[model samples]
Structures are given as C-alpha cells and as structure tokens.
Target: MTDPAIPLGEIVLPCLNEARALPWVLSRIPDGWRAVVVDNGSTDGSAGIARDLGARVVHEPRRGFGAACHAGLLAAEAEIVAFCDCDASLDPGAAERIAAPVRQGSADLVLARRRPTGRGAWPLHARAGNLALARMVRRRTGLGLRDLGPLRAARRRALLELGLTDRRSGYPLQMVVRAADAGWRVEETEVPYRPRTGRSKVTGTWRGTWQTVHDMRKVLR
Candidate 1:
C-alpha cells in the first residue's frame, strides 16, 4: 500500500469547456496522486477552475483530443501515468485500480472497460461505433481489449518510447496498437461509466461518432 502522504502517480485529464464537471472530477483524485489537467482552449474557465482546485494545468493550444493528451503526457512527472476524460463520465478515483497493475509490474498498460451505470450514460451511436472499432483493433493487434476507454494507465517512460504521433482522435487507439506491437502486457478491468456533466464534444452525436470512427480507422490502417 502506498502511503497517503507520498505521491503515487499523475493522471492526465484533457479538458475543453468542462468547468461544471471540474470540481467533481478533481475532488475524486486519490491522496498522493497528481492531476495534470490539459486545457485544450476551453473558453469556460476550465483552466482556472482546475488550477484553483490544486490540479496542475497545462495549456495545449491545439484543438485535438490527441494533441491535448500528448501535451499532458509530456507534462507528466511520475513514473506511472494515467489518462481520464474531464467530462466526469468516468470516475477519476477509479484510476487507482487501473494504475495498480502497472505500478506492481503486473501489466505494462492497463485500460478501463466501461460499464454504463445508468441509461443514457453512453449514447447509442457512440456505443455502436466503439464496438465496431474494438473489433477492428482486435483484428489489427490480436488483442482482446473490449473498450478503447479514456481511463487508462501506463509507465511514463515506456509510453514515451512508443513514440506516439497521432494528434487526433486516433491517439488512444494508436497507443494500444503500438503497445501491442511492442509486446506490452496490455490488460483491462471494468469501471462504472456515468453520464457526463455537459455536452460531449465527441461521441455525443451521429456525426461526432462517425468522425471518431474515421480518425480511429486511420490508426488501424
């Protein structure tokens, strides 16, 4: 067990106009864990909210999901690094379970398989798109990952060595694909998924889901 006073790891949260959800998300971070909130040009004071809440805020001027994630990755200082959405759909507190395997040398990369906690928590189109993409990932990597969820953990140095290059929606999938190629012991566990606090920037509408699928397809190719 890690001492509550000692730092554990850093969790990167990519943000964009998520002020309302910031408080709830930040409060859930476990003791000794650092929160690096990557503000992706949020006009809703998300950056300030994060900073005031004791989360280190990294400003990524670029407006892509991958860009923001990469920025947070570069900013991370701990040996173990995790990533979660700032939308509050996923619990930041649950990162401990996801990260434990990596810290214990049991897994190289740990992903969260989301189990929706309520109706409308996950949109139908988004769910369908994710299923299709997961199938593609299985065929490409020979890995049986169920969900390409944002909540995940890995070693910071190894992740950097993957030399991830995607700066769009394909970033997450590219990480998994590259990890599999490198023979990393990628695994996953279930986490409850709740409805987000505000409008989703992606995977909330049919068009958004299609765009995400398209971006991920580029990685599969």
Candidate 2:
C-alpha cells in the first residue's frame, strides 16, 4: 500500500549479496512508506530481487555499508529516511517503531537498539566492543544513546545538514555524533535481532572487525 503522493518517509536497505533476503527486507516496510535498496556491488542478483519486489534499486558499487547507505540517502526524497540492514538479522517489521519518533517530530535521530533473539545473532567480542563504544559515545557526545545499531531513522534534511563524511562502518557513529553535536534530539528503540540470512559484513571475521575498528577510529578521533 505505497502512497500515491509524496511519501512521508522512505526506508533505505543497504544491500550486498543479499538476494536471498531482499524480499523479506522489503516486505517488512510498512504500508504507505516507500522503500529503496542500495545494491552494493552484489553479484548475487540482489538488485533484480529488489526491483521484482517493487522497490526502487540504486546501484552503489563502493562495497561499503556507509557508501551504500549514503547513496540511498541521496536517492531518497521523503521527508524522513530510515535505514535497515538487508540481511535478515534485523526485523523489518520494526521499521515503523524505529521511525515513529522522527515522524512524530519528537526526535531528530532514532536508533533501533538491538535485542538479539538468537544465540549467534551477535558475537561475544562484538557485543563487548559495541558496548564499550556506546559508553565512549555517551562520554564524548552527551547524547545518552545506548546502541549504534544498524537500523535507524532520521529527518532527511536534518541529517543532510550534519555533513557526515564516513563511507564505511563509521557512518552510523559519525551521524549520531554529528547530530548530537548539532543539538538534535536523539532516541533509541529496542528491535529484535534474529539470526541473519548471511554473514555479517563487519562482525563476521577478524579482518572485518579490525577494518571496522579502524574506520570507527577515524570518525571518533
């Protein structure tokens, strides 16, 4: 039930080799909201899947989460933008919950704090690292946010005004930090994190974790 007129918000799914999960992700978008998938150099036919399911597909061959997300943002024209991981880990059913605060004009930025429902949904070291980073973010920015979860929502214009430059794993952190610095009201909503359809891009291996940490350091510094 997509809106016939300009939509109030749009959900952006940053995808990479997620052909198997694209349908579920797009189906999770609530009625009346528009959906866009940023295909990140997927050789698995993810872009075609998105198109077949009635979602607008934007090609982003940069091969990074932030790069794909930034491309989606540029292509999105709604007043609000919500980002969801294309992998099945994060529930698409919670899109409305995550974007509610922003749509209601009560929050400038909202993060879907993950409540993992499966054992392997999150790795031990990754959880510890994320917690530590969350604390560091609290101390550094005074935003009081609890999670840097992949699922989040923001007012489109306000987000664009932040001038975020990170094109990797650090994009989320950069957005939150810069938004907080600019005095935007930031909030968190708990969303279930299930077992993902495929391996995580950032927490799947030692190399991935190190690269994420390195990129995050560049933003945090």
Top candidate, metric TM-score: 1
TM-score of each: 0.97, 0.94
Write model 2 residue lDDT over 1-221, tens digit each, in one string.
Answer: 65567676788899889988877888887877888899889888888889999998999878788898899999999888988888988876677777888888898888989998988888776777788778878888987777897889887888888887888899988998898888889888898988889878787876677667777867877
* Model 1 C-alpha lDDT versus the unseen true structure: 0.93
Question: What would the per-residue lDDT of candidate 1 be over residues 28-146, giving only the tens digit for each residue?
Answer: 99877999999999999999999999999999999999999999999888888999999999999988888999989999999999999998999899999999999999999999988
Where is model 1 poorest over a 10-residue stretch in terms of lDDT? 1-10
Measured on C-alpha atoms, candidate 2 has an lDDT of 0.84
Deviation in angstroms for 113 in model 2?
A: 0.6
Clash number by candidate, in order: 0, 0
Return the clash pairs for model 2, or none. none
- Against the correct fold, how does model 1 do in TM-score? 0.97
